[model samples]
Target chain A: MIDTIGFDGDDTLWHNESLFSMTQERFRALLAHAADPDDLDRRLLDAERANLKVYGYGIKGFVLSMIESAISVTDGRVPARDLQSLIDFGKAMLEHPVELLPDIADVVEALSHRYRLILITKGDLFDQESKIARSGLAGRFDAVEIVSEKDSASYRRVLERHSVAPDRFVMVGNSVRSDILPVLAIGGHAVHIPYAITWAHEEAEPPDEHYRRIDSVLDLPPLLAAW
Target chain B: MIDTIGFDGDDTLWHNESLFSMTQERFRALLAHAADPDDLDRRLLDAERANLKVYGYGIKGFVLSMIESAISVTDGRVPARDLQSLIDFGKAMLEHPVELLPDIADVVEALSHRYRLILITKGDLFDQESKIARSGLAGRFDAVEIVSEKDSASYRRVLERHSVAPDRFVMVGNSVRSDILPVLAIGGHAVHIPYAITWAHEEAEPPDEHYRRIDSVLDLPPLLAAW
Candidate 1:
């Protein structure tokens, strides 16, 4: 039986990738004078992938990458006003309200009563804290950890700190790379609930037949009930 | 006697503010034709102050603010190449090597043998982790905490999570606002080693007589010995 459960904060609990998608649309339009939408999208993705090491993850990095890509694609011809608009885009995203996934609140509420819930998210500490506070779901989780990366080592570290054995812990999230395989590698159960939108960087190969899969977090309680 | 000790990461343990100072100098020189040095500095500070809420703290936010300030100061006439330079400045800072303060390594080593050492820093989680790992002092600390803010409540929460009592804990750092005041307010001991450079936002009134003050971490050993 799972005594402790971990939840991914971004797409799992609330709308996150949609914000990036919408902003990417704005970003592409802003630079349309210099590059086509397809070209701009490819360039932006390249910048993000290249910058993930130095900038890590979050809206701040995304904005910086956008500016970098705009300059490179435009051959340093991107206007300063356009750059300013990019910065404004980042601010708007940071201030955007948190929107919960379908029935996630009720799912989390029901699960909280049965297991020790931890909000394990990987991103900018300040941004993640802001979202958790605004989500109105902060009180449900026993602990919230905003980490730089979600990997086997990080998962092990967090689990050890929380005095949770891998055997008794289960992770639930959207990204297979971050939420599923790492936990499974560490001997913990993982519940895969794929979101409609997935960032390219977060994409991973399918996990072996070891972990459970669900259509939505709404289906989580019943799945666990059977366990 | 202090059984557990916490150390702040940035200026207390390494050279941090100097980086910002150097970058600000370059920024002013780059925008010399647009605004006077004094005016540019003031504008940049204002932008940073205004952006703290949305952007939080880190090189990423600082870069965004610099771009904002550059555009505002230049009245949107700042060249695209210059804006690209600003983005490059941030990437350079993020990749810059960690420079430890005078004898901080030795000081941490000495204290680690006697007390449980915790490196409690407030900043971007990824940046802080990189600095800590690069500082070669991560192994010396029993635990590390990268938090969003350092206040009384944050201090209390950290202490409770570590199973530490306030009376037996002591926090050592450079910033009076972040490292000293909040720890004292939480009923714990604090040792203040003032850094040469202080950010305007971090400036707080003189802390009360309850806390200990030292000129450097070099002086920390003797001060703790007498206590």
Candidate 2:
């Protein structure tokens, strides 16, 4: 029987990618005259590749890059209007609201009765805490871990802390890199949930046979029931 | 001088949260008949809190939980038409397309001229790999790591393998938990780019520091020019 459940935060329990999509759509519209969608996308990807050195991850760097990309793609000919759009986009993203995924609460409620729940996520401390408080789900977890990254060592630490043997634990999330492999590496079971739009940075290739893949979270209960 | 740059994926470089928001709106609407918006949200939050154990993280488990929540909230009284709406919503989410943030490619191209670039993300292997292939940005990264998680040790390993020092390295991404803190923990610098909507599962508070908070990726050239 599974005694401990490990979870990933972003794109799992809440709305995250849609806002990014909206910003991109606006960006594309802004650059319509300067470059085609393909060309603009290519340039922006190049900028992200370059900026990763100076900016680690988060919206601040992304907005900056968007501005830089606009300027570069426009050959420094970016209109003041476009620049304002970029700034406005950044501000909008910063102030965007938080929303949870469907049925997360009820399903969690059902599972909580039988298992030890832990929230394993990696992000800014204040931002994350605020979201949890806003989510109003902070009280349900037995422990909440805010780490720099999720990997074998992080999993080991979590499992050890919970006194759970690898076999008795499960890791679930949308990304293969963070959710499945590390746990599998340490002999833990993992389930993969594919999202419609995955971020380029979060991209990973999955291996066959070490873990299970489900199309939606709804399938989990039946799968776990079988297990 | 910086020779190589690594990036954290997920919320950093694309539109991610909008889909969740749409689903959330749908969820709230669906439950509006049975409960108030605030109460429904509270219930969903409660379910998410509970499921963190059995499901962990990702859309599959979330989608499942959402279905469960719908069933429970409506006491299995949801109309057949509404059931179709729920199914359609999930289908739409699964079929949702992927798009990059504005100017992302442009910034990478500019930066690639002066530094080696790599992509480091954590998630399921197949999911990440598929995204990378579809993204068409794969060629830009010198190395792409779809890691299981990110932590100080993992960062150390990446740095060691690349023969780089923490001081000279910069990690960028939307996740402070995965991107900023670990780099700082290992003596590397990180830039935080806050996103509009962060996934509750990936949520973590920010550290108390000035160097840690950044307004945008565009701010990097100025900051790093001096560094």
Candidate 3:
């Protein structure tokens, strides 16, 4: 019997990557003269991947990487004005209001009454905290963890801190790389709820038979009930 | 009665503000042609204060504010190269090695064996985590909290989560605004160990007769013993 449920914040509960996608479009347009669209995307991703250890994940890092990529792809010719636009993009993304996925509010509220709900996310500390506050679902969570990354060790640490045994916990998230695989590795059950958009870095292969997958968080209640 | 002790990172455990001070010197040199030193400092601080809500605290936010300030101070004519250099400044600060304050490692290690030690510092999560790991004192900390801000409310929440009462808790750190006042506000004991350099934003008038003021964390063990 699972007494605790871990929920991923970004694409799992609300609209997140979509904001990044929209900004990337703006970013590409701002630097259209410097590089081709596909090339720009590749360079931006490469910069993000390279800087992950240094900058970590978040709008701040994304904006920094975009600025860095713009300079590299343009051979230092990208205008300071364009770089300012990238900074503005970060500000807008950080201020963007949180939008909950379909029926997620009701689902979370119902589940919160039964299980200890933890909203686990990976990103800039301020960005994640603001989103949680704006999500209007903050009251439902018994705990909130804004980690820098999600892996087996991170999962184990979080569980240990909460005094929850792995076998009695269930993680519900959108990214298989972050939410599903790591939890399963730690002997916790995970429910994969595919989101409409996934960041390239979060893409991963689906696990076979070990965990369940649902198209949306709306289906989570019935699935948990049956289990 | 104190069974738990919370230690602040940054300048309290290692060199932090000095790195920023050195980077600011480089930044000033980079934009020397555009503005006066005093004026530039004011502009950067203004930008930082304005962006604090959106950007929070960290090297990434600091770098972004620097770029913004440079553009404003230069009337949007700050060169792309200068902006790139600012980004490099952030990267360097993040990758910089951790230097524990004088006798901090031994002080923390000694305290850890007697009391539950929680490294509670506010800033970018990833950056703080890296600094903790590099400090070679991570094992001494029973818990680590990388919060966005340190306040009475945040302190109350952290202690409650750890099942520690404020009366039985003592926080040691460099900033009175962050480490001393807030913890004391929540009925907890706080030790203020002033760092040589304090960020302007972290400056506050010293409190009278409420908390202990030590020259350094080197003085911590003896003070606690007397208490």
Q: Each prediction's DockQ? A: 0.85, 0.02, 0.80
The best candidate by TM-score is 1
Per-residue lDDT, model 1, residue B108, is 92
**Model 2 chain B poorest 10 in a row by lDDT:** B52-61
Give the per-residue lDDT of model 2 (tens digit) for A72-135: 7877666544554665585576566668777677766677777788888764333455566677
The global C-alpha lDDT for each of the candidates, from Candidate 1 onward, is 0.90, 0.69, 0.89
Better of 2 and 3 by lDDT: 3
Instruction: Supply fnat for every model shown.
Output: 0.79, 0.00, 0.76
Tell me, by lDDT, which candidate is best: 1
What local lDDT does model 2 show for residue A173?
A: 83
Candidate 2 structure lDDT: 0.69
Q: Tell me the spans in candidate 3 whose CA falls farther than 4 Å from its real position.
A: A198-209, B199-210
lDDT of 2 by residue, B114-135 (tens): 7777788764333454456666
Q: Clashing pairs in model 3?
A: none
Ordered from best to worst lDDT, the candidate numbers read 1, 3, 2
lDDT of 1 by residue, B85-176 (tens): 99889889989999999999898999899999999999899899998999999999999998899999999999999999997888999888
Number of the candidate with higher DockQ, 1 or 2: 1
Would you give me the overall lDDT of model 1?
0.90
By summed lDDT, the worst window of 10 consecutive residues in model 1 chain B runs over: B201-210
